[model samples]
Target: MNGLLKKQFGLVLMLMLLAMLMYACAPDEAPVDEGGSSDEEESSSDEGSSEDSSNEGSSDGEISGELEIQYFVGGYGDSWWKEVISDFEEEYPDVSVTEHAGPNINEEMRSRWVSGDPPDVVYIDGAGSSETQMVEDDQLMNLTEWAEGIELEDGSSLVDSFIAEPSTYDGELYSLPLVFDAWGTWYDMNRFEENGYEVPKGFESFMSTMGEIQENEDIEPFVTTGQHPYYFSRGMLYPAFAAHGGNELLADIVQGAEGAWETEEAEEIMSNVEEMVDAGYVDSGLGALNHTQSQMNFLLGDNAFIPVGFWLPNEMEGDKPEDLQYGFIPSPMNPEDEPMAIVPDLRPLAIAEEAENPEAAKAFVEFVFTREYAELFSEHTGAIMNLEGVDLANNENVPEYLIQANEMINDPEQVEIFYKPHPMSADLETPISDSLVSLLLGNITAEEFIQEAEEAAAEYREGQE
Candidate 1:
């Protein structure tokens, strides 16, 4: 009986030892809840879902949506747009872009804008598009905050990169200046050199130069369009006004202040035009010509100098003579001592107030304002972008005249740039343009032009009231 009891104890001890060895060899079990899922497994599942949510659009968390862009086709053309869009797609592969662009895009997109379902982005240029009107109609998004702190790829402030700041209303930015265009006088360098003519420095030099050109060259010394008299009024007269009376006079003229156009400065500018007309330095047949016709005449060597924008070369690219060498200068409307004044004509780019894809729109805006794109713009458009620090002089693709003009534009000592606080109303501009045509044709005196302009300003103000 003692031996059997000992055997039973030994068997029990062996069974207990086997159980301990099995427990040691088996895998560890996690703490499980009532649902049969372990805590560790639940945690891992939650982490995986979080990662997927973070990368919904792309692995790098890029925005993905339909981005509609509206741009106008003009002298700049649409090649740059196509290339940039392709590049943007490569950067954000998931985003889809739709272009609403053409020469008449402003008119074509009018209905969409009126119905409050405009495209994501809009380039305010060409006919039928006015940035001021858009602001009044509440069609643009306020980009002041986003623009203030935005940075370029090289760690420079985006706003600081602009050659000119965007126009603002009530201290809020609505549009960015995308194109850097300035009104100035254009001539053929080769023609001037052949005639031994010098570029004018100021009003006095301008008159003398015109006289010299008139006496020597068979071509008209100066030419401007009557159909678009703003070529003279805004291009030459406005800059002269600023140079004479500074920004204060410009503000008054823009506001249509009573007799603003009859100031001493205005009289002097009109008198200068009168002097040119009386001397026969002005083209007598301009009253019958439109902008393109006048420009064509200038390009054909019928005229020695013409007032126009930087787009002249690009606009007349196909028609320009092979021997023609473009030359540009700010209208020498200032006195001999004062620096030349530049009136920059900025084309604005805006975001719609009701964009379907705000993120993509903002992203595109940021993407477009880089130096790389600015150089591309110069390469494709043959004109400068609104960005600062673009090296156009060294670029073989850029025209030599544009390179020289850009240097003058950036030199503060050579030029003083200014803008009117507001755009002139159609009512005000129409009569001014008409009177200018009459004045240039030698039918109206300087005093008469001023009287007509002041009367028009009064009428515009009364209509506004």
Candidate 2:
């Protein structure tokens, strides 16, 4: 009887040890929900969830939803943007797209914001207008999160060269930089060769050539419109400002500091403008002219050089005289200062904060960033592709000087968005531009011009506060 009892005890001990080992290795299932269940069962159920968490689906795919996009395309003046949108619709069939043309895009957007009805995605001119204000107001989406998963064509950062930090606010990206537009001096090569003049090397050389052309060839060396201040700010004045001071002046001005325009560095710039007026480099008629008039003169070859953007090729298309060999160069710089290139203004598309289909808007931005769409845009507009790894087209329409300008951008040391950083306001560029025109027309002395500009700038700052 004692031996039988000892055997039973040993057998029970072995069974208990075996049960413990099984519990350690096995996954716990959901505890049978018994209101009377012990703590041990709940602990067992929690352990089972760890394995399931690791198996969650992580596949990436395009999503679909109702999306509304408001785009302004007056400058493009063609089917290019329309075609691209149609292509987007076909590619993402499930995404229902509603398109509204934002007439007077800036004013329309401002009105819509007041009415509390803004579009999901919209396009605004990058000529340093009201778009920057929207970014500051946090009206745009923070695209960094959405861009992380994207793999660009070259397997690099999704937002490549032209589309990066310029749209950033407080270290977070707000909008996408779409097509790149850089301002420079557009020229007619046929006329240049015909006149037997070497391309101007620097500011002095350019002015000398302009003088010679005016005196000998009887052509308007340069033509500009002073009626709109943007022409002066972007095309003539700002470029000269960057040339004189190493591009930091504008940023300093934006940050409540004086710009080089008020410093000794600006003497060369102001002197150049004064010299142009005295020597007849620019048309004497510019006092009443407008931006379109400047481009019109260049296209007619009545003016040899016009300050404009790469988009001039598209803008001048039908109006461009036959056999017009047009090209572009960096706006003439102060000979001593290091060369500075404009960070091409990006035609960014931003999703409104209240956008009903934020995901679809983001997806559209992603799709447009792809090489196919980027290349399509470049081809259509004769504009540079914003995507990485895509080569600048060597087509018949691309001007040689534009190619040279693009080379200047390759140097990381020289290219920057310094001048373009100012947020748009009715009070900012307009007042300064008018002051510049006043200086040109001898209505305001240079010192008076500087003081008035500073006063207007101070008012803008106060409004912001």
Candidate 3:
């Protein structure tokens, strides 16, 4: 009996040993690979994400929608615009850009808006009736909301400059600044140098230079249009105001603050224009001539200086000789102040409120904001991009002096938004642009002009209330 029990115990021990061996040999739990290998997988995933982001830069050459864009016939039909639109259509096969061009864009827009079929986007140059009216009637869409939350590839915010601020009302953006056609004087460098005269800096210096020209040379020192009547005010009056104390004085006047207009500063500005006319520094033909003819006279060397802006270059395209050394300078003022000033007005692109293709309109606006388009538009317009990182080259038409003038205006301290904030009136602009003309023509005394301007401003302020 003892022998049989011992044998049974040995058999049980053997079975236990075999089970232990099997457990030891069973794959040793395969020592699972730790996070070190997983790092490779993570890197691959990151690279894929980076590639996806790169693909999203400025949208691929793929667009498929029907688009209708309306531009001023004056600036349309350029090679760059043609190429851009063609490329856009090729990318977006389904999209079509049908341009409606005419001399009376405002009339066309007004009719279209009344007919309830306004184009997807309409351009405004401060000439299209009233921007405030459009906003109040809800005929224009608020662009602020559309522009928000959209970021460029480098994650920069889109267009922080308030080029459209004056047009904004009640803290809402109604339009986007398509082009900033700032105003200044165009000079003939060769004529100035030949006459042994330097471009004047301030009011005193400017008049002295003109006086020298008057005494030594037979050419009129400055020539501008009188019928349009706004040129002198913009090129002469506003810049003078800026030289005195920047936009503060004009702002006070527009806002009807204490002692705004009728100040010595305002009188000085009027006197400057009057003195030019009285001294025969302005063309004798100025009172009867229109803007085009005035510009033509300058191109023909009958005049030495013109009060104009960037569009002058384009308008004189064929008329101006290739070697004509044209230059632009800021309106001369007192040297005690900033050397130059910028009058910020916008040529805006607004989406109609009742647009049928709101999505497409938004898409087109984004396309316009793209760097590629901005660069082309800047070069073609003979203007620089308000947006950064754009490629630009100054031609002979845009002389070095003009480029310097542009730079000075772009300087932060010298730039000011023209017109008053929300409570301001377009009616005020009419008077300022008109009264200065009357002052130049000697029809109204400087005192009378200021008084009339004050009254007009008061009426506008009351209406705003």
Q: What are the lDDT figures for the candidates, one per model?
A: 0.83, 0.65, 0.65
The residue pairs in collision within model 1 are: none
lDDT of 1 by residue, 345-367 (tens): 78878899988777788888888
How would the candidate models be sorted by lDDT, starting from the highest?
1, 2, 3
Model 1 TM-score is 0.81
Write the residue-wise lDDT of candidate 3 on 1-465 in tens digits.
Answer: 999999999999999999999998887333324655355444443453363432121233333334566666453225555676677667654455666545466777677788877777666543445565677668888887768765554576666533344356667887776666667778788878887887776667677787787778677877889776666766666667766756687566545564577788877776676777677777766788888899888888777778786777766678986657877766775453545555654566778888755655666666666566666665566654446654343344443543665566656665443543432345666766677666666676777777888887777677667
List the candidates' TM-scores in order.
0.81, 0.78, 0.76
- The TM-score-based order of candidates, best leading, equals 1, 2, 3
- Report clash pairs, candidate 3: 63-92, 65-95, 202-333, 203-333
Better of 2 and 3 by lDDT: 2
Clashes of each: 0, 0, 4
- Give the TM-score comparing model 3 with the true structure, all chains together: 0.76
Candidate closer to the true structure by lDDT (higher is better), 1 or 2: 1
